[model samples]
Target: MELTDNLKRVKKPDWLRVKLPTGKEYVKVRGIVSEHKLHTICESGNCPNMGECWGAGTATFMILGNICTRSCGFCAVATGKPKPADWDEPKRIAYSVKLMGVKHCVITSVDRDDLKDGGSIIWAETIKEIRAISPETKFECLIPDFAGKWENLQRIIDVKPDIVSHNIETVRRLTAQVRIQAKYDRSLEVLKRLDEADVKTKCGLMVGLGETEEEIYETINDLSNVKCDVLTIGQYLQPTPKHIPVAKFVHPDDFKKYREYALGKGFRFVESGPLVRSSYHAEKHIF
Candidate 1:
């Protein structure tokens, strides 16, 4: 598992390249997001599929403001003292979903450790407002671990989004290095609690961060033990030099193998590829 300095700067493969955002639909989606003053992980995380997803008229909306309290090494979201929670964000997000005509929307947020409730109140309100405004629209929430507070986690479960996702982000060995303040087992507990609540729980992992195939399988087994329903595996791309470097570029064939392995492990749905992300093709996982 030793990585040379040369591997850190290895050129990105052609399969990783993506088109720039364009098209009228993309523009319309962008306009709606801008008009509502909303944030999206697609833009904040520099997702390669933003063009494809936005052009298709679907976008993942990020609430609770752009600033994050935790500074995860793998994330591109700004980490610092976040502003006070905007109580009206729920209505605005609901309105934005209505304006975009999104049939299935994904909602995620920055880790709000500063708040006593970890912003779960706003999380519940947002889901309620969305259901009120767009009764037919399905929702998938990529929530924070709430610092393992069961009460905060219960708020989300009480609101009951269609599918609830909380990414493990990396293998167990790399969890501390990548996530800093977050604990790997706490993440599992969060998903486990979601599953226990009869919620359709999902978790995501990023490979190519110096973890071995064995470690990946162990993580998958851990998730399966908790009865996690959906899983996503994507290559880890370094957002900047300051972030953790990509130890390897997993081949597409390897991604295929991982997908099949996860399916066999009893994950109802598995999305695996170099470009796959937590919210990529998220709508299809609702079932």
Candidate 2:
């Protein structure tokens, strides 16, 4: 299907509209973020479920600053030359998690190809800092491919997070069209490296980007071949008009089928739905 031909703003389904609640943890987490002058993709990506997630004392922290170096057509993050890595950012992030009393934390970062180590040292430090403050909290790192750099990948692996994720973003056929400056083989190689390193690897794919069901299944097979432990499949929502458009919104039932299929294919965890991101409701699933 031609995704561009289907470009239109359909109202989010009722199931997707989450209600926000007030709580001590919510207020405390908000206050901490404000005090640290931190930015979260959970807020900046305009995540529809942010209120529900945050209200439930759950959050995904975006590290390595907000400005990304690569301009992937499907992403909402701004692409530009990023500022220098903040040495204190890790400590501040840890403080925010402590204040929130989060049981599980998802740490991700923008593509900082500008950095020599692709910000992997900062990622490692962030993981260590989070662990130091919240020893009982489960940690997940949804990292970049480090532009396929091994030195950068090794740094994060040395920290030994519970899960290390690098999103494939789209089907292999649409890789070139949908992902600017990202190669399909390079992504596969990243997963392969994670598998070889024996880390609990996770990868995600976005549908509604002109990819066929066969392509999606092929992607699942590819991820399985790389021994990825977690698979998250979600419908692609165009972040803006200039970005790649969604072909169609897969139904909730369809998502369930995909989830079942992924499980049958031997994924340890499958988070499949229109609203499922890499770290959505992560705390509940990890334990």
- What TM-score does each of the candidates earn? 0.97, 0.93
* Backbone clash tally (model 2): 0
Instruction: Give the winner by lDDT.
Output: 1
Off by over 4 Å in 1: 1-7
The model with the greatest TM-score is 1
Candidate 2 residue pairs in clash (backbone atoms < 3 Å): none
Stretches > 4 Å off in candidate 2:
1-15, 18-24, 285-287
User: What digit string (tens of lDDT, one per residue) describes model 2 on residues 1-287?
Assistant: 53456567666666565466567766766777778888888886877677777777777889989999998888899999899999999999998888777778889999998888899888989899989989998888888889888988999878888888889989888898788799888888888888798888888888878788889889898888888888998888777888877667788998898899899999898999888887776765563
Compared with the true structure, what per-residue lDDT tens digits does model 1 show for residues 79-166? Answer: 9999999999999999999988889999999999999999999999999999998999998999999998899999999988999999
How does candidate 2 fare on TM-score?
A: 0.93
> What local lDDT score does residue 282 receive in model 1, on the 0 to 100 scale?
93
